[model samples]
Target: MTPVTSRVEYSPIKRARVYMKHEMGIPERRIALEEGISPGSVSGIIRRYPIQKDATSCARSGRPPKLSDRDKRAILRLIKKDPYITTHNLIVAAGLDVSKRTLLRWLKHEGIVHKPAF
Candidate 1:
């Protein structure tokens, strides 16, 4: 027999319980009055809710890091070695297989002030 994994996903209302009780140091009814929510709803949330455990704050991991340390160093080195290098020329010399937008993003991340290409 395989064990079932029971994951409890509490609603925002439920999460509000702990915040109201422990953090806010007030009853649900008072909280609801201040927040403009009904006292009954707050009571329901407080009564039938599980307290949230302290979880490590993890990054959302939406997008990956644009430039690696090596890439950043390479860019800084290139700029320092020759301040006259254009964005187009740098992209070619650095051999970074990315669009001009991506390249610009990398430059921006490295705090490199890029002149508008006329």
Candidate 2:
């Protein structure tokens, strides 16, 4: 009995063929038929070819920071001065424009986990 393998690896030749098809203005379906690969694979290969060739991947964009470095430093100093300060008190003391939820998120990101009293 022969063993079954689940992994499928495409060779450089297949990648080159996809690029060549795109260069020759061939449609994705036709390229898939000729290359014996799925149309989605052909489309993905063409789309990612430039990035792969340049060795540069796309950068991910997330929500911008509400507090700047200086503000964060001030908050840290405030926390250090009074270790038991509540989130609401910290926001008022630091004069931060952010909400208590935002402050808690920032504190959590800074590795300061606060558990509520039972």
Candidate 3:
């Protein structure tokens, strides 16, 4: 059987222990020994403590919006002025740099209904 290892590095439990050690002025080596982790791992945790303190397990992912609130408002105004404006026309009129699909998705997200080209 393999030997048991220390708690997972960067885990909440390990981070908490690292914080406690840091607060109590405990040495990295001692904390490593007590927690069955490596001194380097403990050191890394201590170094990153400040930044990680406010972090949770779940991190926000994905790219930010290409269009800002002002841009979105401009698109809304254009749509309001002419309800029959096509997505292509809207992109050109508003100087939006996003693709047609992205614009359509944004419109859908903003609850803007597109009229059929009947």
RMSD, every candidate, angstroms = 10.8, 10.4, 9.9
Q: Which should have the higher TM-score, number 1 or number 2?
A: 2
lDDT of 2 by residue, 47-100 (tens): 887777542334446667799898899999998999899888888888999988
Query: In candidate 3, what are the lDDT values of residues 1-118, reduced to their tens digit?
Result: 1226664536687677777887899878889899887888788777776776452343446677788888898998998899889899999999999999989887887778755678
Error of 3 at 55 (Å): 7.8
Candidate lDDT scores, in order, read: 0.63, 0.80, 0.78
lDDT of 1 by residue, 1-118 (tens): 1225563334565455545563557866677776566676566555544443332222334566666678767878898999889878887887766678877776775578757789
Off by over 4 Å in 2: 1-63, 115-118
Q: Predictions ranked by lDDT, top down?
A: 2, 3, 1
Q: State candidate 2's TM-score.
A: 0.46
Off by over 4 Å in 1: 1-55, 114-118
Q: Which candidate number would show the highest TM-score if scored against the true structure?
A: 3
Worst 10 residues of 1 by lDDT: 51-60
TM-score rank, highest first?
3, 2, 1
40: Cα error in model 2, Å: 16
Count of clashes, each model: 0, 0, 0
Least accurate 10 contiguous residues by lDDT in model 3: 1-10
